[model samples]
Target chain A: DQQVKQNSPSLSVQEGRISILNCDYTNSMFDYFLWYKKYPAEGPTFLISISSIKDKNEDGRFTVFLNKSAKHLSLHIVPSQPGDSAVYFCAAVITGGGNKLTFGTGTQLKVEL
Target chain B: DAGITQSPRHKVTETGTPVTLRCHQTENHRYMYWYRQDPGHGLRLIHYSYGVKDTDKGEVSDGYSVSRSKTEDFLLTLESATSSQTSVYFCAIRSGTGNSPLHFGNGTRLTVT
Candidate 1:
């Protein structure tokens, strides 16, 4: 069974617009959520994260919001640029669960000019 | 850059053969993980190591094995290759500290025919 799910397989947005990616999880034990950005031939890079204790966390143009009651989370990137086009993966982890991360299928984001 | 490197960026092996992928880290982090990425399945952990000579299986550990003999190296080996095992493999590391995100290596693309 997939503990984490990214319903959207792909998304497109115009430059300078806002891009939102959503994810859901079935495991209530997950206490931490993270978003990672991956280029075609590179490894995933950490973008932003939100703890279950907080409803939102923001960094620069990236913001992550968590709704623990709904077992859902979203990542928002404002003023999306061409460089933001890539595969976005949402991952979750249970605190003290040996730091094992469960990841979603991923959403391919394309920021168009 | 988290100083993570995955060797053999690409490999093609035949069925019944053995394949091993290497992951080296300069960070000396306490946690190392091996994950496989497939079309519909996101990143599923095969195995992980918490410390030198300490390891555990993850969600998909049936046909895989892992070894961590030193602080800087983690290895994933497929004892017998199969077409179903063809996928991209990623290695990740994280510090033992609180709520730290994982850093991933570029990845290794393995094709079994």
Candidate 2:
């Protein structure tokens, strides 16, 4: 059983527009959520994260909103650029689970010029 | 960018052959992880280590084994290669502090023929 799920396989947006990627989880024990960006042939890089206590966290053009009640989270990128095109993964971890992460399938984001 | 390096970036081997991938870290972090990324499967942990000679299995550890004789190195070995094991492998490191995000090495692409 997949604890985390990224329902959308891909998303496309125009440059300067907003791109939103969504994820869901079934495990209530997950207390931390993170987003990672991956380029072709490269490992994933940490992007932004939101704790269970916070509903939203923003950094630069990236913002992550967590809805604990719905067991869902979303990543928004405003003014999306070409460089933002890549596969984005959502990961969740239980607070005391030794930082072991459970990952979603992933969503491929493409920002067009 | 956490000073993690995965050796043998690409490898192709015949079935039943044994293969080992190496992950080296210069950050001196106490946590190291091995993950495999495949199409439609995002990233799944194979194994992880918390300290020297301390290792644990992750969600997908059935066909793999890991060793951590030192804090700076973690090794993942496949006793016998199989076509089902062909995938890209990544190594990640994190501080011992809980809730810390992970930093990853480039990756190693392994193909079993």
Candidate 3:
């Protein structure tokens, strides 16, 4: 079973607009959530993360919001740039669980000019 | 970028052949992980190591084996390649500290025919 799910396979947004990617998890033990951005033939890079204790976390142009009660989270990138076009993955980890991560399928984001 | 490197960025092997992928880290991190990314499945852990000579199987460790004889290297071996095993593999590293995000290597694309 897939513990984490990214319903949207792809997304497109205009430059300077806000891009929102959503994710959901079925595991309640997951306490930490992270977002990673990956370019073609490259590894996923850590972006922003939110702990279950907090509802939101922000880093520069990226913001992540968590709704623990709904077992859902979302990543928002404001003023999206062309460079932001890539595959975004949402991952979750359970606290004290040896740091193993469960990742969602991924959403391909295309920032258009 | 994290000092993680995955060797053999691309490989093609025939069925019944054995294939091994290497992951090297310059960061001296104590944790290393091997994950496979497939079309409908995001990134699934194949194996992981916490210390020298210590390793554990992940959720998708069936046809795979791993070794960690040293701190800076972790290896994933596919015994008898199969078409089903064709996928992109990624190596990740993290500090021993809890809740730290993982840093990933570029990736290795393996094709089994």
The candidate maximizing DockQ is: 3
Clashes by residue pair, model 1: none
Over 4 Å off in model 3, which ranges?
none
How is the predicted docking of candidate 2 categorized under the CAPRI scheme? high
For model 3, residues B5-50, the per-residue Cα lDDT tens digits are 8999999999999999999999999999999999889999999998
DockQ for candidate 1, please give it: 0.91
* Model 1 segments more than 4 A misplaced: none
Model 3: chain B TM-score relative to the native chain B: 0.98
Candidate 1's residue-wise lDDT over B1-113, tens digit each?
A: 59999999999999999999999999989999999999889889999999999999999999998899999999999999999999999999999899999999999999999
The TM-scores, one per candidate, come to: 0.98, 0.99, 0.98
Residue B91 deviation, candidate 3, in Å? 0.5
Ranked by DockQ, the better of candidates 1 and 3 is 3
Per-residue accuracy of model 1 over A20-54 as CA lDDT, tens digit each: 99999999999999999999878889999999999
**Tens-place lDDT digits, model 3, residues A39-83:** 999999999999999999999999999999999999999989999
Q: What is the interface RMSD of each candidate, in Å?
A: 0.6, 0.8, 0.6
**What's model 2's overall lDDT?**
0.94
